[model samples]
Target: LKPLGFEGGPELVCQSLAEGPFGIESQADVDSVAMPLRKLVEGDNSSAAFVIACYSDPGLQVCREGTDRPVFGIAECGVLTALARAETFGVIAIAQRSIPRHMRYLRQMGLTERLAGERPLNMSVAET
Candidate 1:
C-alpha cells in the first residue's frame, strides 16, 4: 500500500469469533462467520476500506451492504489482478475440496470462462 502512494500503509484488523471454526474449510464454516463479519464491518468507523482476507470471501456481500466504505475480498482482488495481467488465470487452493466452491464463485462472478484452471495444495488453512 505504501508503494502504491498512500501516505500511511494499510492497517491490519484481525478478528476472531467466539464460536467460529478454527478454519473456514467448508460452506458451513463460511455461513457461520458471515453475520459476525458483517457486524465487525458495520461497527468499524475509522478504516477507509475493508478487505476480507478469506479465500471463500465469507460475508463479503453482507459487509458491503452494511457499510458505506469500500469492501474488497481477497479472492476477488486476486482474480481481478490476474485478469488485468493475463488473458486467463489459475487458482491455487488450500484443498482439493475447495476447488469446487471456488469454481462456483468464479461462475457467480461470470469469470469462469477466463479461468485457466485451479489446483490444490492439499493443505489446511493453518498449515498454509
Candidate 2:
C-alpha cells in the first residue's frame, strides 16, 4: 500500500467474533458481524482508511455512516477494479449463500450488467 502512496502503509485488522458463525455464508451471518464491526471501527481513532476485509462487507454502509474516513470493502473494490479493466467479470466466492448478498450489492452499485457470473468454491471462510 505504501508503494501506492498510502503513507505509513496500511494496517490490517482481523475480526474474530465469538458470538457469530465462523463463516459468512448467509445474510444472518453477515448481519451478525455488522454491529460488532461498526463498533470496532467506531472505537478506532487513528486509521486514515478502513478496509472491511471480508468480501461480503457486512457492515460497510453502517460503518461509513459512522466515520468521515474512507471505508472500502474488498468485494466492492475487486468488482469495481475488474469492471474498469473488463466489460464483464466473474466472481469467485467462498460460499453459495454469499452470492445473493453480492448480487444485491452489485445491483445497488448499478453494476450488475457488468457481471458475467458468480461461482462458489464450496469452502468455509476459514478454509479459503
Candidate 3:
C-alpha cells in the first residue's frame, strides 16, 4: 500500500464480533457480520475508502449504502484485476460449498461470462 502512494500506509481494522463465527465460510456467517460491518463503515471518518478484506465480501452493499466513501470488496477487486490482465478469469475458492455462492454472486454482477472457471482448495479459511 505504501508503494501505491499511500504514504502513511493503510490502517487495518479487525473488528471482533461477540457471537460471530470464527470465520466467514458460509452465507450465515456473512449475514452475521453485515450489520456490524455497516456500522464500522458508517463510523469511520479518517479512511479515504473502505476495503472489505473477506473474499465473500460480507456487508459490501450495506457498507456502501451507509457511507459516501468508496467501498471495495476483495472478491470484486480480484475479478476486476483479473479482467484487466485477461479476457477471462478463474477463481480459487476455499471450499467446494463456496463455489455455488460465488457463482451466484458472479451471476448477480453479470460477470459470469467473464469467469473461465472456479476451483476449491477444499480447506477451511484458517487453513488457507
Candidate 4:
C-alpha cells in the first residue's frame, strides 16, 4: 500500500485471548476465541487475515470451517506451506514436554515422514 501510495486504515492485533469466554476451565477455549474471527470474516468486517498463535493451533480447524476468509496458525501454516512447496521438510520445535503433542499433530496431518530429522532445542514450552 505504501508503494502504491495508498494509505492503510487503523489495525488491531490482539493476542493471548483465546480464552476470552471459555478460558481454561472450558478446556475448549478455541471455541470461544473463534467467534470473533468468524464474525469478522462472515460479516465482511475484516480488512486482512487473522492469525492465531498458539502452539496448540487453537481454533484452526473450525475457523476454516466457519469462515471463507483465510486463516492461519503459525506452526500449522509453516509446515503445511513447506510441504506444499517442497517434497520434504523438517520440523524444528523445542524438544520439550510438548514433543508428544506435536508429533501427534504431525501424524494427524500426515506429515510425519516429511520430518527429515529433528534437532531438539531441549527447551520446554514453559522454559522458553
Candidate 5:
C-alpha cells in the first residue's frame, strides 16, 4: 500500500505461525513470527486502526480489548469487500476444515447470502 500512497508493512508474530501447513494454530498465537507490535502504541507513531490478515481472526478480539485501535482481518475483509462488489463470490479454500470456518466467518459478517460457494481443495493448505 505504501507504493500506492498508503503505508504498509509486514509483521510476523511467531515462528510457529507458519511452521505448520496452516499459517497459524490458535487464535491467541496469531500475534507472530516473533514480533511485539503492541509496543508501537505506547512509544510513538501510533495507529488508531489496525487490520490483521488471517482467516482465523487471531488475537483480534484480544487486540481490540487491549487497545483502542480498530482492527480488521483479511478473510472477513475479502468477504466484506466482495459484498460491496458482488452479491456472491466463490471461496477456494485450502482444506475441508476451512470451508466451515470460512462459512462461519461469513455468517459472522452477516454475509451468508453474499458467500456464493465453498469449494474445499480437500488437501493440506500448502499443497494448494
Candidate 6:
C-alpha cells in the first residue's frame, strides 16, 4: 500500500484491530471482531474511506453503518471488479473453513453464479 501511494497518489493508511480473532475461518471469527472494528472505524478521523483488509471482510456493514465515508471490503471489491471484467472468477482462500463463509457472502450478494471456484491454501496468517 505504501509503495502504491507514492508519487502524489492518494495517501493510504493501514491499521490492524488489536483485540480480535487473529485468523478468521468461521462466522464466529468474523463476529468476534465486530465491536473492535466499529470502534476503530469510529475513532479514525483521518481517512475519507475505510477498507476492511481481511479477506473475510469482518464487520464490513458495521463499519459502514457508523460512517458516511466509503467502506470497502476487499473480498467484495475484488469479486465485483473481477465480475465486471470476466465471465467467472475464483478465490484462493487461506483455509478450507473459510470457503463456506466466502460462499455465503457471494450468495448473499447474488454473485454465486459468477463464482467459478474457491481453493484454500489451508494456512494460517502466521504461516502466510
The C-alpha lDDT values of all candidates are 0.86, 0.82, 0.85, 0.63, 0.57, 0.87
Judge candidate 4 at residue 11 and give its lDDT.
61
Least accurate stretch of 10 residues (summed lDDT) in model 6?
A: 119-128
Per-residue error at 44 for model 2, in Å?
A: 0.5
Residue runs of model 5 more than 4 Å from their true location after superposition = 1-22, 25-48, 121-128
Residue-level lDDT of model 4, residues 1-128, one tens digit each, is 23434447546556455336533223255455666655554665554666766655666877778776677888788887888899888665543445666777788888888877544477444654
When summed lDDT is taken over every stretch of 10 residues in candidate 4, the lowest stretch is 18-27
> Tens digit of lDDT per residue, candidate 3, span 15-102?
5556667877888888989999888778878888988888888899999999989999999999989899999998988878888889
Residue 105 alpha-carbon offset, candidate 2, angstroms: 1.7
TM-score of 5: 0.59
| Top of the candidates by lDDT | 6
Q: How many residue pairs clash in each candidate?
A: 0, 0, 0, 0, 10, 0
lDDT for each residue of candidate 1 in 40-97, tens digit (9 for 90 to 100): 8888889889888889998999999999899999999999999999999988888787
* Top-TM-score candidate index: 6
TM-score of each: 0.84, 0.80, 0.81, 0.58, 0.59, 0.90
The candidate 1 region of ten consecutive residues with least summed lDDT is 1-10
6-79 per-residue lDDT for model 6 (tens digits): 68678887787778777888899899998889888898888888889998889999999988899999998999
TM-score of 6: 0.90
Evaluate residue 126 in candidate 1 and report its C-alpha lDDT on the 0 to 100 scale: 67
Cα lDDT of model 3 overall? 0.85
Any runs in candidate 1 off by more than 4 Å, and if so which? Answer: 1-7, 123-128
What shift in Å separates residue 84 of candidate 6 from its native position after superposition? 0.9
* Residue-by-residue lDDT tens digits, candidate 5, 46-127: 4556666656665565555657657666776776687778768777776565566666667776777756677666754465
